[model samples]
Target: MAKIILNRENLFHNLNLISKQAKGIEKVAIVLKDNAYGHGLLEIAKLASEYGIKKAVVRTHEEALKINNFFEDVLILADVENSTYSHTFHIAVNSLEQIKKLPINTKVHLKIDSGMHRNGINKKQLKEAIIGICEQNLKFTGLFTHYRCADELSTDFYWQRSNFEQIKQEVKSTCEKLSIPTPKFHSANSSALFRVKDFDEDFARVGIATYGYLETDTIFNNPKLKPVMSFWAQKISTREIKKGQRIGYGGSYFAKKDMTVSTYDVGYGDGFLRLNEKHKYITPKGYKILGRVSMDNLSINSQDEEVCIFDDVRQLAKIHDTITYEIITTLNPNIKKEII
Candidate 1:
């Protein structure tokens, strides 16, 4: 059977690195949405609690409920509907309509659309959103924005930051005028937390970096992060095939010469992909996957008793032409997760 091995030491190292990067910030909210980036929610939540992390971010009320007791605050980045759970979670108000719908006195983080245009109220609607939050008696706890190009080498980040700065000033001034206490402001995400020197905000909401999947050249060049998860599977069977013998569905691969192949207990159903011949995946020891990945099994050109699928998701992301977050989060949560 295939299983995930989590290195607690490596996770601690990455958390420590994040703390160092967030030295000047008032708080560091670990983004645990997507099941802690597929590292296991309860497990990583326990670790974060033990590490003295006081804040966390999730995508839904259910996710926040799972780890609500672990942190002083759990901010829900999405699903801002009024519900019984609204009182327990700090909801993110991404639009003026959402602000109006929130229950009275519900805690919220005002999301200003600096430039992402994916979420948050537009800059033009900032005043209306703030007024709605105030009129509805919602407790404005924080103000924030998302960066669309913080991971890339582009000037768009600067423009977004400038717009957020303007939003910050407006939020503060408007709160003061309405006799409401100013909320804490934050904008830097995982990439901006490291790349932006002016990230002296109330908190840094870090996600990918905590899970060891940084994508920026600036962070990668420094190399302080360590991947925490390693995937492995045991060889279930082995066989030798003659030259020209076809393998797997569609005869996608043929044995060039008499060679050994071992079947392992992991496949696309386990969150792995059936790569085509042109993008054959390799094992840690450089043995190639022989053919199409089955739902619950895959064949590899190796006879080892066990095999390491991957220790870092970046390699898998590269082959899949996607991001590391997608690769790691796709890992089936049903697989056994062992913390070492």
Candidate 2:
């Protein structure tokens, strides 16, 4: 069976890196939206609590509820339909209608559309949403925006920041007129938190970086981040093949020499990619995955009793031409996870 190991030291190292980047912020809101990016939601939440993280962010009310006991505040970023806001769990209001529909006195955060255009109220609706929040007496705990290209080497991030600045000013002015105190504001995600030095926001929402993966590498200087997750699988069976013999379902690979091969309990079913010749999955010991990967297992040229599937997620992500977040989050949650 496959297993995942979480290094507590590595996790803390990553968190410390984010803390250093968030020098002036009051708090760093750890983002645990996807089961702590598949590191185990409750597990990571408890770890964060041990490290004194006061706030966290998740995608749904269910996820927020799971970790509410560990953090002082848990912000629900989406799924407003099932959300019942409270002092501990705050809902992010992306639209004016969403805010108006909220129960009176429900804690909320206003999400403004700076440039992502994915979720959040546009500039045109900003004023109306603020006014409605005051009229309805909703607890406006925070206001925030998401940047579309904060991870890329582009100038668009500055533009988004400019827009957010204007939106913040508008929010403050409107709150003052309505005799409502201005809410805490934040917009720096993992990418912006490291890339943008002048991000003097109330809070830094650190996501992928908290889990030890940087989305962008173009930025010249960066803090060292230790990967926290390591995957391993034990050999279930072993066999030897002739030089000219074919292996696996498609017989895509032909043995150039008689060699030993072992089947491990991991494959696409376990979220390991069924890679082809162009992007072959290689074991840490330099053994290549033979032929097409099966649903339940994959064959590798190794005699060892166990093998490290992946120590650094970036290797798998590069081979799949995707991001590290997808690689880690796609791992089957049922796989036994051990915190080291």
Candidate 3:
């Protein structure tokens, strides 16, 4: 008894809208990292490719292979430790070891640390790393980095991107001597590209953005973007609750007085894992979320009203004390996701 509906139309629009943000680009890589951020890789990525999305990015080496079977043209941006010599898809390599060992003819990218403290080569070691790779000729087709901040304009963000400038200069000089196209450069993620105009890159590896989500006010303020995923559920049952009646597990909620109650056939197991008592729910006809969320069920105070589950993720997260990413990614198959 799942009332959830996935609006394929909105999803498509979201992807298109985000992609359109990159003006005059010959090709754009639709990031499919994290199973397309839980939108279902096979379905969403296939649709993206069908819509002429020429490229895509994933997190791990295994993920690259998982999508490659379906998307032969996927442009994988993560490192593949076990990849063979002629494997299809671009890879992001970190250090001298990878540059030395990676197959010479493979299409791969050299990633710089930039200041995220997560991955890539450090600024101090940039020139040395580039020289080593160019000398060995590891098919250095691209150079990129991850933006630590695009949600806020602060010193943290500045220093992170500053390294990109430094690395870009070094790599450009080396690429010229090695006779490679100034390895197409890219660094900004969703929040950066959508929010700050100057933060644009040759190619932005967008995941949440394509799904119609801008992490902060900077991008959400952009009237051009739209919410692609409108999550919906149905109000299966409604009844009146008497005073003093305890609601849900552990008696977490109790009726202050006689009131209307509704049941939604989804709970924590169904990706409704909000432990907050003030969480809300929306049905095709109305909105509410009443008591403790169970493994396969949750209660909502329906005042006999109805709304589709196809509301905004922002609303659900407000009710659940979590984030939009968690709500969407954590949703289990316990609730059906049908494209509308």
Model number with the top lDDT: 2
Q: Residue 22 CA error for candidate 2 (Å)?
A: 0.1
Q: For candidate 1, lDDT tens digit of each residue in 173-289?
A: 888888888998988888888886545788999999888878886633454789989999889999998999998999888888999888999999988866766776777778888
Give the better candidate number (1 or 3) by TM-score.
Answer: 1
Candidate number with greatest TM-score: 2
| Per-candidate TM-score against the hidden true structure | 0.94, 0.96, 0.83
Candidate 3: Cα lDDT at 206 = 72
lDDT of 1 at 42: 87
The digit string of per-residue lDDT tens for model 2 on 1-340 reads 6999899999998888788788832469999998889888988999989988899999998898788789888888886574456579888998888877888888889999998889988899888888888788788889999989988888899899999999899888988887888999999889888887665888989989888888876654667788888988889999989999999887888999999999999988988777866777777778888898889898899988889988888888888899999999998888888899
lDDT of 3 by residue, 1-340 (tens): 5544555677777666666777633345778877666666666776776666666788777777776755544455556474473355777778767777776666777788887789887777776776776677556667888877667656676777776887788878877876767877888677766665544567777777677676665524663555555544456688888999988888878788998887766667767565666544554455456666778767777643334554567766666666677777776634444556
Q: Tell me model 2's lDDT, rounded to 2 decimals.
A: 0.86
Greater-lDDT candidate between 2 and 3: 2
Per-candidate local distance difference test: 0.85, 0.86, 0.68
The candidate, 1 or 3, that scores higher on lDDT is: 1
Measured with C-alpha atoms, the lDDT of residue 102 in candidate 3 is 70
RMSD (Cα, Å) of model 3? 3.4
